[model samples]
Target chain A: MAEREINIEDITKIEGHANLLIKIENDELKEVRLGVHEGKRFFEKFMVGRSYKKIPEMAGRICGICTVAHEIAAARAVENALSVKVPECVEMARNMMLISSHIQSHLLHLCFLALPDYVGKDNSLEMDVETLKKIYKVKEAANRMTEIIGGRAVHPCDVVVGGFSREIGREDAERYGKLIKEAMPILEEIASVFLTLDYPDIRRQNNFASLYGDEFSLYRGMIKTSKYVFEEGEYEKYIEERSIDYSNANRVFVRGEDFMVGALARLNFNEIDGRAKEMMNEHGIKFPSNNSCHMNIAQALEMVYFAEKAMEIADEFNGCSERGEVKNENGEGVAIIEAPRGLLLHHYVIEKGKVRYANIITPTAMNLESMERDLRWHVEKILNRDDEEIKKEAEKLIRAYDPCISCSVHVARVV
Target chain B: MKIGVFSLTCCEGCSVQFLNIESDILKLVEKFDIKNFRLIKERNEMPVDIAFVEGFPSNDEEVEKLSYIRENSKILVSMGACASNAGIPGMVNYAGKKAKGIKEYVDVDYFLYGCPFSIDELMELISCIFHGKEFRNKNQNVCSECYLRGVDCLLDKHILCMGGVARAGCNAVCPYNGHECSACRGGYEGIDIKSHARLLLSKGFSEEEIIDAYEMYMHEYVEELKKWLKER
Candidate 1:
């Protein structure tokens, strides 16, 4: 086992199918190919000839975990192409949906995907039932908040170009408001328990980027980092997306450099929400972190932060009114938003009310290259460790980044 | 009964919906051994009493995996529009190439339909499997459930709704939520596709609108959809 040519097929605790092939020849790391083991849905290819009205629904199908991410991003993109701007209230609700959906997504990552690793278990089910129940209860409240406003958790019906397809009533907003209030403390309790785990740490110079806002926000932002900033419309000037031969998904580079996106990236540049920041300070967690495992901590903090935000939006929502008027026209628009995972970009050109061109760069594809780079560094650093320890450490590292294989595989395979 | 939840090449929305079962999801782990649900946990290569697989076999690796899972389980429930009919991703076949589902590669005991089905319906199907009860799929149209729920028909408002011929088991949720029923569920038994299109056309909708609605789940049957739209 010492002279190992390890092929870790089907890396667990992530979405879609991804594997790693590591060739350690004479105990020297010779090759590390992070393979995307998925069937390319080629969403970009299929989006051609689709009506702008249909683009959000179809694009939203690209990933279930971040359906709202795709729906809102696509809707905003189409709305931009049509030069349509909904009333302030409609924008508020859209932002509310975007913000609340993160609560569901972050909890899903923390409770189901990453928690088991901290406990040295294969699955969360192996944990005691009471702990699972408490977490699910909190997660259920988050789901209710998303569904009450966004139509449903998986694929929101109200989210469409030109504003909400249906107005979420005042009663529905208040209902979710109460639901989230009751669950917030329980969420904090779970976060306290999770923070006690022995998190692995490594400081690296990985480039971190996210959507920018005055305070922590997911919608209506430009891409910002320590080195540079770019407007949503000027996304192309700063970023380049190209196919990599080893995977089904395309990788994004910020001027030929692999960077990170999602919560860790968002926190690196944006002003933290006051309540969320207070919670972080209480727990002794600070931002601009270089540790990859801190990504999970970032998600945990974001879960509570967004949960508080969801409560405020749900309480204040009067109802959706004065939605944007959609007209059939030809134009192009680009939208950059922070998904639960990281920065998600949706760009579209609509011709005569149909989507003529679409390019979606997901957080997973954006993080994949950076993740592999980190993987290589960790594997080389631990080459002297036993095979069992090596595999366990490898999985924990990959899971920390929370790569969504289906989201990444949505890109057309490059030949 | 031991259960396994497997997702292939779709959005994994059905899996998210399963998690949307919420706190009952904890009860689910207590009641049944979910040997391999990738979303909640890893270690997905084990045998089970009931296998719930979502999405289509979109590649050689998936086709091979589907065959292996079929061999490992006694009952395999194809768990969404993608598993049953390739869902929206079936649009990749608009070029006349075929989009393949789990059924194409192996035997499927039952289906829970939708772009993604509701949690109640999924639990009901799974409970039936656990109790050894005879299983049945809802055979009514979406309009039936909408009517039963006293929902306003979008058609009356000239909204070009597709509920008249869409499958009903989702309890007409899209319509209840003030949507026009884009027909995520495939058409129900004896669905009157021609008349539904004609009626929408009479209400000021275009032929293209009707075609686009069906494309959500029936994109693989694009030829038949256009044929049905044009007839009479």
Candidate 2:
């Protein structure tokens, strides 16, 4: 019998600040805590009394990595409150911005952040020069797409409540279309490198939650969980959340159970492009995956699907379309979009012309419970290993979720 | 010289935006020994030559970390709006928990300002420090840069833009795209905010809207706006 105590004071190479603590007694895992110590930005409470037209701008500060996701979700939530229906072209424009976001986020995570671990390196900077260039080229192109469509890579100004303030001109559309086409092969090659990596073979069945739909869409969808499926309007009724004393982020549960969301969840529920199915086969992988490590592969495959979607939107581009006008009505709205990581929810209550209340639940916050559970399960198999090895494996499991700590701590349901 | 890039509690947009420098980032890696950037590297050595810190000290842990950065580094450059004037994270400042800037806690030598800050300025500052030259923070407002770029004045359209007072460095990207400047950067070297408010009020924009255009952020300009109203 042996006792072990492991504490990763700060996990490195991820988005924001986080730590892990574990206590083992008699060779059995007793206590494990995945602590999200990032300070609360209080976006939900600060947004109170702010004009509805500017929530997306404020919301964009939630997470720099997933800025577009917050902006789109906030805009959709604002639109829902006012009962404003945007045009098909406006939706198309938003969809393109989201797809571009997926490309850059996935590229950044897999290459700059997560790739080094899989490739037997400390970080991507330590990798060979040629590999870094290839990743840089692909990442740069993806970032350019996000910049072109969303106005800036980190916080977008073009994405507004009703629709984009600046119209997508024909020249911009053509340039965007060309960028997607040129970057396709390199992006696929980069995805192949990740998809074909040697990942830990740990598989377990758990509940999956994501935006429910058949089409390759991120802007609109229903809430789909393994046990139950519900519309975005019924989210709070189905998804139960309460804050714990230790972490600033609330623990989210579906039907009173910790569930997994993000890229893997969406792949299980949605219908991807036809070529993507072949891709999983090509890489000797399958959908509805149970392993957490497979989340990386899911993200890689998603990059390909999103690029094609971006191309389709680009080809369909004709001219500047009309944006929806805000009515300044009083109501409540909830928007659920499949962010690059997984399900992103932005809910708002509008009274007069200002935001009366806001409740935002990010992908990382939803994945926290599952992460702690998986850390326990992961540590159990490697209990005999030393402290450093156990720490690395646990971090890999958490990193596989691509958890954005800032997003999780960015908002809370405060009255 | 060793380089360290640290983040406290922010969107980490400034750090993320650093990588968005695209190809120049690769060249940067070859030029500088960036040993302590947690966003890209895992192995980090301390007591560096230049330390660029984003986000403000919102809690005790962050405040402790800031002091450590100041103590360990030779040149401490407070990067972005959060570290400079408590950017979006400053929203908590209004709730009575003031998120103070880095300069409030530590003796900062150079300051790089922007919402996500300016990567161009960051790169320029690094070379200046590396080459033993002085780095001067941009003092012009976004309106000046907007005029230079020929971006249409949103004020002419009755849009309550903060470009007239917001610091320049982001090249007026938001205004050029037809969006108003939300003042992610702190105010430029200022003389008169009262007259600007007067102009905005004359343009039929409500005083409240103009104030919120700056997002009521914790900055000197918003206070000036409030005090001007009080004097009136």
Candidate 3:
């Protein structure tokens, strides 16, 4: 009998550092740990004692790729805490920001990070010059959409607790509408490229959880699983996060079950745009795909959905003043928004206009457990294979989730 | 020439910005052999002619990573505010451990200064290196850019703008719009932190608010600024 340890010290092409540790004894898998070694910045802990107004800016620093999502989620939480009702226009602008983020992040992931793996390339740098330019153009369009609504692509500065810091005009919306409309073909082209990729056929029918609504909503919605539906604020009652010693990230469970979130989950529960739906149907991928590899296809479909959604939102927005009065008192806020990777939760307890406590559970944190499960299942399937082959298959499965390890790991409250 | 782009503990925004260069990035890549870039290319541990390192070394492991990178490369360029002056990563000063810039542990030949590092500034440095041309680095305050753009003074609205002292070349992007400069680019040398504090204080901002403004990006100098405010 022989024992072996397969340790991948640093996983590349992802946002942050994570090491996959697998221990096998005589062909039996014993221990599996995905250790997220990103040094804890203690964002939730440090956010305490800061004014409510500054929390969005501080929270935006969590991840560069999804800064707009963090800022929006933080703003929503603060608004929830303060009981502030922003105008419809502000909500529209925020939606535009979220949509823009999905486009940018999904493009970056599918094209730069995940695409290479399927295309038999080591990295996106190996992408042909023409394909690279086309992808970059689409990304720039998404960034432009974000810039029009949120002010800038990276860490939007306009979103405030009550509303927005600056008003968005109808002309700007129209301008963005044109840009988004123009990006439709490019997005389809990108989706076609993703469709060509061969995903390893591995299916695990785990519980899928995402925001359930009449429409595909990244903002206000209730958590919908296969069995139960929980209100947005009631997430704590349903899901519990346990702090693990080996990793900086926390493992979350819903009713003692590990579930997945992100494009696959969102698609499983909600109705996406018609164009995206058509594209998905063309490939015989109906909603609620159990195959994790389908997550990449869902992401590509989402890019198409976001482009159309952005244009529609742009048309409806008539412009409004950004000022909303805040009557701040002691209050608690919790916000759950769909980040590019998956569902992101931002919770804050404000006391006398200052943040007394903060907790952020990123998408990658929720996916970490499910990622390990998928890895174990895949490893067992390829147990007879060589070590390098196992490692490659495992890495591919992990990348399929588009895990932002840095965004996932943060300070967890010890009981 | 072989070039490498490495990141440590901060948001990899600066490295992303390099990709944000769009089609221009393809042209740039043609000039230099990118021996190592974790975000785009496969990770390579080989030595390079120039290495652009982003983020601060917050832990011992990162310190080792930075040391190894510095030792391998001929010219080490601190790519963002974090690698140069401890940007947002240093916001946790009370966490007991100091988040240090790369230069704190190893020699750095250049500092591509900004919160996320300006794309233009990065290209300027790269152009100088590739073309063997002399490029003078500018350290003007953000207010200078505001002046050039003819943007109205934010101070007129009794707003606390860090542009008066914070490093320029961001085109005063924040102030040009409605928002005040939060000083994501950090401060220039010879600026009086005390005077800026006094200005904010005189404008009815409390000492705490002024400190918070400075602490957002200027983690390196906030302690001295706080001490100066306390004495005043």
Candidate 4:
């Protein structure tokens, strides 16, 4: 009978700081606002006087969990702006980095962060020792793959704009290939463990977006939406970011509507095959599943997909090739890659080899609208339930996106 | 011991690194009570024996929370470069007010300095604390590690590497792996920044390039380097 406002501060297990405010009155949802309060680092503005070559390194610091994703996106953007044709080896190296990145991030989300929720535990620390050890093995394998290719598990050093700074020898490739080969069954065991967990059943109709390619991709791909298609550089023309008073992150809209991006979105649009597809079918996960909680399952399945993909890439590896020199020019480029969370975009405008303007749109910002929609649906469904129950379910839905508020907030443009 | 892990403004990379040492952490947790860790725990309130605070306090809210943490803990350790030296998040401070580290607002018992803190050092620190042993600092520069590992000196190749000046203890992972040192760790104490700048300039690197390289990670100390250069 009275107005009820619920405010959640610093949601746990996600990458950054964000809060949710929901108001309801007389069984009708009044307003839902997702707020990001991470401190403002003016990354876009700081790169104004910097050379295009430094963009990826600077941008890579934007997120630690998705450093490889940001680095690749920034490098691709610079390469696109300069119209530089990267060597074939560079593309292969980048794909390796992406697959490795996805593996680590997905394992982090699925086993460490999201597992506690479905299994009735506080955190992975509370899980059984054997289960934790298996998860650790997956994380280790993922990190080893990154270290083999990118040179560091975190912010990789060898991956530059034109090509890599070092070489991945046959020994390095074979070592990680062995790790991936050993990781496949471990991943299947992890997937089987996740399949037993409880996933909340809630579906909402929303447009799904992902990079359309020949196969499930984290590297170069065409932009595909549910209905229309666009080029990577043409994102600004269709996707718009609007500032809100409640949060520093700008809520993004695709063609004036809230669309979804991330693992679930990828699953909805992309045709997945092999071990991952078989696992999904075994678990009865069909396409266009709007359940946000299924994102955890999607992440677990992605681990299988990326492990197989990484092994295939590693098996064909000969050695690193000569990197060509990059010729800078005055041009604009937009590069989009699928981060561990979802679609990540980095746009750069270069002038005389210097970055005149730069903008980055992280997946979390794009997911905020849909996350809020999910919260509203779930909260309203359980309005008559206990308040504690509603809050628990709401937080669970929000964490499913693996939102990175630190990546979402940039105050340089605002200032 | 009851431990708390807190974060503020920077990317939570250091926390991820802390968790990345998965099996070791599981063993460590058995020895100590993890009272509060927001990344892993839901309840963040407890009487903490030691608190490992990550990220820099870039706003008033962060400052208030950090102060509360300092008040509630017996010993507070600034973990990672952001907390101790305001790493990448503090780069914006170059154009504005200097970003304050944890020590700026509250007393810090120890400082574990690195862009993303080193896992080995973290393990050592934890072991020392649990055993009540004084943790000896590694005072050598990264170049020493590079020399020990037989990693080629980038200076000979005319590639600008920060190993000669940046602090050691990262085991020269970057250089040994074929990438020049980017100085994820802060500089060795009292290293000559002016000489390093001149060396880079003689190598045909532009002044901007030298300054940019030196100030990328630990920009908090760049002001001191500039002052020392001016005096010379």
- Top candidate by DockQ: 2
Give the range where candidate 4 chain A is weakest over 10 consecutive residues by summed lDDT: A406-415
Which candidate would rank higher by DockQ, 1 or 4?
Answer: 1
Q: What local distance difference test score does each model get?
A: 0.81, 0.84, 0.82, 0.81
> Mind giving the per-residue lDDT tens digits that candidate 2 earns over A1-415?
7778999888898888888899999988899998888887888887998988888888888888899999999999999989997888888778888898888999989998888887778888888889888888888887788888878878877888778878777677778889989988888888888888888766764799988766657888778888998999898788888788878788999879889998888888877765666787887787888898888999999998888888888899775658887666789999999888888888999998888989898998899899888888888888998888888888788788888888888785553
True contacts kept of each: 0.82, 0.75, 0.48, 0.53
Give the DockQ of candidate 1.
0.76
Flag regions of model 4 displaced more than 4 Å: A410-412, B94-96, B221-232
* Per-residue accuracy of model 1 over A135-225 as CA lDDT, tens digit each: 7888787777778777787898867677776776788878888887898888888777656677776566468898776766788776786
Q: Compared with the true structure, what per-residue lDDT tens digits does model 4 show for residues B80-176? A: 8889878765666633567767888899987787767788888888889888899865777899999899988887887778777788988888888
Deviation from native of the Cα of residue A377 in model 4, angstroms? 2.2
Candidate 4, A1-415: lDDT as tens digits: 7878777888887778888887889878887778888778778877787877778777888888999999999999999998888877678778888888888888888876777777778787888888888888878888888888888887777777787777778788898889889878888898777766787776884687889877778887888887778889789888898887888788888988887888888887788778888887887878778777778877777778878888888888787766757765789999999998889999999998889988889898888888888787777777877666777888788888888888887433645
DockQ of each: 0.76, 0.78, 0.62, 0.63
Q: Which stretches of candidate 2 lie over 4 Å from their true place?
A: A413-415, B94-96
In Å, residue A266's CA in model 3 sits off its true spot by 0.0
Which CAPRI quality tier does the interface of model 2 achieve?
Answer: medium
Per-prediction TM-score of chain B? 0.92, 0.93, 0.93, 0.92
- Clashes found in each candidate (C-alpha, N, C closer than 3 A): 2, 2, 0, 0
Cand. 3 TM to true fold: 0.97
For candidate 1, chain B by itself scores a TM value of 0.92
Candidate with top TM-score is 2
